[model samples]
Target: MRTEEYAMHDHRRLGRELGLFDTDPLMGAGLPYWLPDGAVVRHVLEEYVRDAERAAGYRHVYSPVLGKRELYEISGHWAHYSEDMFPPMRLGGEEVVLRPSLCPHHALIYRSRSRSYRELPLRMAELGCMYRSEPSGVLGGLTRVRAIQLNDAHVFCTLEQAVGEARAALALIRRAYVDLGIRAARFRLSLPGEGGKYVADPELWSRATALLREALDGIAYEEAAGEAAFYGPKIDVQIADPAGRESTLSTVQIDFHQPERFGLGYIGADGARHRPVMVHRSVVGSVERAVAHLVEQHGGAFPVWLAPVQLLVLPVGEAQEEDAHDVVRRALALGLRAEVADPGQGTLGARVRAARLVPYVAVLGEREAGAGLAAVRLRDGRRPGAVPVEELLGRIGGVARARGAELWEAS
Candidate 1:
């Protein structure tokens, strides 16, 4: 409540102090327990991911959070990225590993069926909760938790369709960010390095990387880089926080070697079996990391749709309580997450304090009952004095529709 006090995201101490989430020392670090409000934000992220996947023709499937250990071995993941995984467990005398990525599981899905050329580009998506046993020091808040909910998926397509899939993923990420009014992200066409883990032959990496690069031209990135995944080169959507830290939040990696590693193939139109290229892409990165980025980026002042509660109807007194209920009912009917603050909680100052602390567009005062007008205040502790209740609702609804960064940008 002090003017100089930084928000929870601005001050890590504040996040833990506020009870949004928790990190435990006894849990061996990088682990978090989601409070009820934190869970709401996580659910919001999944909804965004699902909407994008559906529009892009991705079929959703729920896969087990843990996969048999041999599955990673067969996919060459154990050989390269094993250190990131938790210790394997004994399941029916076989080792089972908590999934660190979704590609291997998705590969098994593709392997479940006899392939047809008509289904060359099979897009499979899952918001798979996975575990990566990062050492204690690597976990910081939600940004680098040991447990991760990954918005992960894969596109199994004939080599010719790989570029199209990559471009589609790029378009979806850009569109989602633009619609959210986030113009800070920069897409990088990550290229392979000299002696990189790319499919051994230099020519294949160059060709595939070049093809993906061509798709990124004119997309307006802050810069490009030679940093790439081991299997292939692709795009990494690098985002920066206000604190000047940069991290890749979404990635589209072209994996030419993985299909061959697993002997994956489909009947081509030419009537012969051919290896399909696998594009591993994630739109929101680890939901934990995405949440951390968003918290810091907006200083924990989330936008309307992303906000846990879009608005809090604040009645000035007992007389206006029914009208406050009316406003809350209307907001809820319109599908904007709305709630009526407990009138008995405390004085008006305490009500405003609670609303501001929880980040809600607070509607206050008696004008709301007189002419169905509203005394509007933002979650950021901004009061718009008084305005017509209908007009206030329209304004807040527009902001929520666009997922605006703040409720009252004009004021």
Candidate 2:
């Protein structure tokens, strides 16, 4: 697709047309409500990340969306990152704020119990919700929203193990991008610039930056000062919009400041306490932004595995309705998101057009339905002619299960 066409594939317009998500004046600007279809996509993506994290030895955890004001104060967010954070709310004499980051809670979780050398590399992950106090002018669609569901994770590891952990996190980010078909615009090493809202610890900053550099060893990256988080330096996986505007989709950072501030440590083999380095990583930074990019990346034609509705069954006429419904049921049984386009809803041609973005469309007519076959049409304009119902289901299911980029080749 042309660059301009990609720009035109704005998620805001496609979202409404495809009935993925919506926003309202009464419901507030940045808080978008995902329609049923959008919810399916988001759920699948989140589950994928969770499964990946589990396989990578990351223990999933849930933390409250709101945190005590003193928590951020201790983490230095109140000092260095308060502008982006929502204001604290007075609650029965104590104050709490919607968390802007998940690291503080994870830090507390790590410190909840005494740790030994064996658990040095404890990876904690969460699909946590956090709020940003974005201005009214910046509140756009899914890309720039007030409330974010971040695919966040942090590893508390000994200083010696920090680089390896960060490298592993980078590999996970790259794998996710390949599976999701997202192209990285560039890789960036975001560092502390001349002067900004950053932790003023020279020794810790230098150590964190060097570790990130070592982790990014052979990878090509650009250095951008003042782009580092308040606490550390990070390697950011940048993606571009249709207009060539770049944004971070994934990141791996090494932080030494938070552990010191939170007084986190582990018992060493020599029977002494030592601070563990914090590796902050995200496979897909924000679920909302990832989906927005996916929406534009494939236009509305998502790959079968990620597509909200993988299969659309269309009956030639009312006489074939039962057969169409049966096909949908069978597809559903194969773990496909299948639905029949009701004959009463529109003409067969119109129905097919309406489901143009769907990865697979099965047309059931009297001949095919009677013979237990389906005339399958792929979204990429390929027709494999009429095939037996069982074979069609198996082929599509296999491809979807494999998360392949294309359907089975036509025979």
Candidate 3:
């Protein structure tokens, strides 16, 4: 057997080879079409994050991808961020634009009703699809795309709650990275400095930055000048790929300007209306980028729980075809993503080679079929002898349910 590595670790190439996703010239650049295999991985990740957010007291909501131009204007995106946003479209005498961020919409939700101090720290979450007018030259694979689905959330809380909320956001980021086996090389406290891009409020910026610092007291992070958004100071979670290239995958921002601009307020215990602070957080900044990162991080060999095709069943010959079908049925019944390879498609060795990237492979032969067993082959070069169909089901199901990063041992 020959073992080698590609000179260029491009996700575009890996995505094609794995049948994950693709882009078309006719469809336009930076717009990726998620193939079935790719969609499965995305679905798993989305569900995982959704459950995590729910447990963290975030109430999920669905918001439109387009909003009135004035919404962004009120949120300060129109004056400061219009260049990166798509040009506004006029419809029925009203100008609308594809939302570049979910912050404004979330602020609207918070202001839809009269909130009180008792309901402070209202966490709103959404897997929001957003669009940006990215330059064609910079568009590359899933990492940099014109359209993105962000794992985004915003918290409207009192000043006293902002610090705790920021710390909780950091904890969520750490837990997510740990679960996905991603290592953040460093954290960066991005502050506004000598830039017209930031809101001109020294006191707000100082207070916001200090709150972030207090929340991150024991955590290590470096200060980055002028890296913040126009509306806020943020903490960026930076990670490095195998090639030593680094990118920010997660962020927690403290926004003091948006609430004031939108007039977002809640009744305080002192019987007065006070502006609430907004905390913007994303566990995985972009689902597409996260997939690209994982593809490279694992060299396209995804863990069983996240693998597009967790198991592939191969029939040794025509006589075992029924057995292979049965295996697939059993696997599917247990919620395992499994399929049977065409017996006539290729030789057993060729078929096995074709499925090497899959996490698990089950070879069904005359002996195995008669005994109601399967010869299991693991991607890690483990060839476990024939095992009962029921046992194999339990093993695969257990690992998937547990979100285990490795295959279960066949004893």
Candidate 4:
């Protein structure tokens, strides 16, 4: 598609057209309310990431969006990141602020209990909420919203294990991108640059930078000074939009600062205290931006497993309503997301076209309904001949369960 026309497929427009999300003046800029469809997509994405984390031995945690002002002071966010953070709010006697990051809370979780060297790699994950004080001009759809739901995780491990953990995190990111249809435009070794609010620890910075390089050992990446997080160096996975504008969608960072500031320590094998290194990584950084990118990447035609409406059932006429609904029920019972479009809504052809982005469209007519079959039409315009309802549901269910990128499950 031409660039001008491709702009129409931008997530902002698709959000409105596809009932994904929207912004209201009364609600203010930089905040968008996700519509029902958008919420479904978000929920699915969160669940997928959570499951992935769990399978990788990461324990999930929940942290409040607001933290005591003292928390940020200790984490160094107040000193270096206050410009981008929302101002503190007074609650009774204590001052609290909307957290700009989840690292501080995760750090506290780690400190909550005494740790031993046996749990050296304590992986903690959360689909947490955070906010930014973005200017209106910089705020756009889900891409640049002030309210962010991040798929964030932190790995607290021994210095010897930090590089290996970082590499594992990067591998997980690559796997996620392949399934989500995201193409990384580049991999960046983000380092602190001149004039940046970087932690003034030269030795720590040098060591962390070297560790990240080891994590990205064989991967080709350009070293970009000044692009690193305030605390440490990172490997940033970059993706571009249809218009060729690029942004970071995933990251893996090695940090030696937070543990020191938070006084985090674990009992060593020799029965002495040792500071554990912290590694921060996000397979898909912000859920909002990730979905926005996916919207544009597939033009709202998400992979079967990620589609808000996996299957749309259309009845050829009122006489087929019962059969159409039956098909929907069977699909739903098989753990598929299915919906039925009444014959009264529109013509069969019109209904199918209306749901062109849906992964599967099952048309039930009197003839097919009598034979207990459905004529399946795929989003990419393939009409898989009529098959028994049970068989069709089973195939789609298998694909969704496998999180298959293609409409058909691989043999």
**Can you list the residue pairs that collide in candidate 1?**
none
Could you give candidate 2's per-residue lDDT for residues 298-321 as a string of tens digits? 888898899999889889999999
In candidate 4, what are the lDDT values of residues 19-116, reduced to their tens digit? 99988899999889999999999999989898889999999999999999999999999999999999889999999999999999999999999999
Error of model 3, residue 69, in angstroms: 1.0
TM-score for candidate 2, please give it: 0.98
Question: What overall lDDT, based on C-alpha atoms, would model 1 receive against the true structure?
Answer: 0.76
| Tens-place lDDT digits, model 3, residues 90-188 | 999999999999999998889999999999889999998999999999999899999999999999999999999999999999998878878898999
- What overall lDDT, based on C-alpha atoms, would model 4 receive against the true structure? 0.92
> Per-candidate TM vs. native?
0.87, 0.98, 0.97, 0.98
Error of 4 at 283 (Å): 0.6
Q: TM-score for model 3?
A: 0.97
Clashing pairs in 3: none
Report every candidate's CA lDDT.
0.76, 0.92, 0.90, 0.92
lDDT of 2 at 260: 94
List runs of model 4 lying over 4 Å from the truth: 408-411
Q: After best superposition, candidate 4 residue 374: deviation in angstroms?
A: 0.8
